[model samples]
Each structure stands twice: as C-alpha cells, then as structure tokens.
Target: MLRLKSLGIVSLICLVAACENSGANYQPVIDGPVGPNYDIDLAQCQSLAARQGAFDSTTGASAGTGALAAGGTTAVLNNKGTNVRDAAIVGAVAGIAAGAVQQQQNKAAIVRNCMRSRGYNVVG
Candidate 1:
C-alpha cells in the first residue's frame, strides 16, 4: 500500500527526468574546419548512440541492491518498520532513475569519442 505510493512517486520523478534528458539536443563542439565527411560521421555516431539502450543488467542489480538496503535501513530504524516495503520500493526506483541518467551520459560520451576517433577536434 504505502510502498506502492512511494514507488509511484519515484516512478514519476524518473519519468520526468527521462523526458528532460530526451528533449535535450546534444551537439559536439568542433575546434576547427569541418571536413566533408563530418555530417556522415556525425550521423553514424548518433546512430550508434541511439542504439545504446538505457536499462541494462547492472541497472537491475542496482535496483535490487537499493531495495535490500532500503528495507534493511527501514527495519533497523523502526523495529517493526511497517514502511520497509515502501522504502525498498522508493530505493529501487531511485536506482532505476540513476541508471537512466547514467546511460544518457554514456550516450553523449560515445558520440564525442566517436567524433574524436574520426579526427574531428571535438572540444566539448
């Protein structure tokens, strides 16, 4: 009951964060003149980045860890912590949200690195 509510709140937060990140347009900063293949290279790199999905096995593991930690902490703090399940749900949601943000960052890095490997002076 309470756990479900907490999970709902956490889910909402993660949803909002994901939406914000997705709406952002990422552009690599070039240090010099653009080559003729610049567009092609960029398109390829972006395609690669797009293929990088947000959730992975690590994300699932993190959620489990969060659940365990939250449940344990809640139990310890309140003895009969009726809210243990709720806390666990919230922790798992937080972990999932963190994972999502991390993946977004990873995608950006991939694009930058791909450009750099192609001999573009990506300053950003």
Candidate 2:
C-alpha cells in the first residue's frame, strides 16, 4: 500500500510537471491599436504566467487529501477484499484533473490581467 501510494504521488508529480502553461496562446481582444512594445509586453506577461502556473500547490494537497479520503471510505464501506489502493488512485487522479484545470484557468487569467495592467485595453 505504501509503495502504491508513493508511486501514485510520483506519477501525479510527473504529470503536473509535464503540463504546458496555456497562457502562451492567450489572444486578448485589443480595443485599439497596440503600442510598439505590445509583442514584447505580451511575451513577458505570458512568460510570467507560465512560470506562475508551472506548479499548482493544490495539486499535491488535493491529491493527498483525496487519496486518504477515498482509501478510508473504501476500507470502511468495502471491508471484504477492499482494494483501497485502486480507490486511492482514482481519487488522486480526479484531484489532479481538477487541480490542472484550475491551474490552466489561473494561467489564462494571469496573462489577461497582466496585459490589462500594461495598458493593453483587454476587452475580452
């Protein structure tokens, strides 16, 4: 069980680390003509967003929490031949998915907000 849990955590970490920050593709709707430094500013903001979105803290936290919760619940409900490891893995996967989605949203928002702060007039 310990080995299985450790393997799940390692896999989750690897997946999170390999995820690409979607902020690089953010194309905000500019209300008017862009400044001369628009491309540079956008690139900088995208880089910042990517760095910020590199690793979401909630991913590990939620994975651990979900694994424990699911394992405990499964053990309690299915006492006979209960596969707690499988349940834990499922829970961890779900947590990872949720965290990844939130991280992507955060990345996009970061890009958008950073552009707006730099006077880009992001209408979208």
Candidate 3:
C-alpha cells in the first residue's frame, strides 16, 4: 500500500540520517598517491575495524530481539498499519537497518581512530 511504503520510506530515511549523523563531519585522509605504505596501513585499519566491530555482537543481537519484539507488539496492537504482513515487513526492515547502521558506525569509528593515530586529522 502507498501508506505502508511511505511509512517505510520515512522510517528508513530517519534511521539512515541518524546513523549518518554519527560521522557526518568526519573527513578521512585518503589523499595522496597510492603506495605500499598506504595499502599496509589501510589493511591494518581494516583489521582494527574487524576487531572493533566484533564488540557489536551483543548490540546486534539486542537490536534483532527488539525489532522482533516490536514487530510482534505492532501485530498485537492491531491498529492501523499494524497488520501481520506489514508487521513482518517492518520488523525485517528495522532489524536490517539497525544492523547496517551499527556496522557503518563501527567502521567509521575504526577508520577515524586509525587515521588519527597515524597523524591524519580526521574531523567529525
């Protein structure tokens, strides 16, 4: 339905905007010519990102649980825009959106920290 789609679009935009704000002003140092040192440093930063992201397992699980719980609650509400199919779609969207935001935030933090530590001014 148009209403459902619009709700989803709004929710998605709000969610993405919120996440984008987490690193909105950040400008990473990816300038200069590519070379071996850049590649090695980038790889190290990626490794650090992986480690930093690992801390999000619990957060991810909690987000999943919350989305599912909210979805179920919406269905039980049985009010407008709370039908079963719509509830499921909302739940899936919420879970995926939240997970994606968390990952992006983590990666941004990792890269910012890494670059900053390497004497690059990462402003956020």
Candidate 4:
C-alpha cells in the first residue's frame, strides 16, 4: 500500500507538470505597417510570448492543490484493496485536464495581447 501511494503521488506530479508546461504556438501578424522594423517586432513578440508562458506557469497551482487534496483523501480510504489506485487515477486525470485547459487559455490570450500590442490584428 505504501508503494502504491508513492507511485500515485509520482504519477500525479508528472501529470500536473505536463499540463502546466503545455502551450499554444501562434504567429503574429502585422495589421498596420512595420516594413523595415518587422524583424524587431517579431523578436519582441517572441520574447513577450516566452515571458507570458513563464508568468502563466501558476495556472497549474490549482491542479497541484487538487491533487494534494485527492492524495489526502486516498490516504484516508486506502484500507480497501484497489480503492486508492482507482481514486488516485481519477483525481489525477481530472486535475490534469483542468490544468491543461487553463494553460491553453492563458497561452492564447498572451499571444493575442502581445500581437495586438505590436499593432497586429491577430487571428486565431
């Protein structure tokens, strides 16, 4: 049982990390004009995207917290055979999904805002 609990915790951490690190790739467009300065603007947008991704890493905090709560619950109900495994699997999946969704949302918003700030009308 102890080994199983350890495995479940490791699994949960991996899932949450994967979800938080996920992001969208978007190319910025120039709506107005930048002919000569296009390269500079593009580089700036790329930097902004990287910063945004770093800033958005916190999106998975909720997922991690949820996983911790689930772990606690599993520890409590771990007396029966297979119950801990089943609960941990379900909890990890749900938390990962939630975190992934939030991460994607943050990535898109960042791209859109960054492009817009650069005088580009970004389209999905």
> Which candidate leads the pack in lDDT?
2
Best by TM-score: 1
Please give the TM-score that candidate 1 achieves against the real structure. 0.80
- Clash pairs, candidate 3, are none
| lDDT (10s digit) by residue, model 4, range 13-113 | 67655654344354555455556765666566555555543224554565566656776698786755367555655565566556556665676567668
Rate residue 53 of model 4 by lDDT.
Answer: 39
Q: What's model 1's lDDT at 46?
A: 82
lDDT of the candidates, in the order given = 0.76, 0.79, 0.63, 0.60
lDDT tens digits by residue: candidate 2, 10-106: 8766766666666455777889999999989989988888777654888888778887888889989885444887897878776776788778778
| Candidate 4 wrongly placed segments (more than 4 Å) | 1-24, 29-34, 53-61, 64-81
lDDT for each residue of candidate 1 in 74-117, tens digit (9 for 90 to 100): 98897666688778887887777766776677778888899999
- Identify the runs in model 1 with alpha carbons over 4 angstroms from their true place: 1-25
Give the clashing pairs for model 4: none
TM-score of each model, paired residue for residue: 0.80, 0.72, 0.48, 0.51
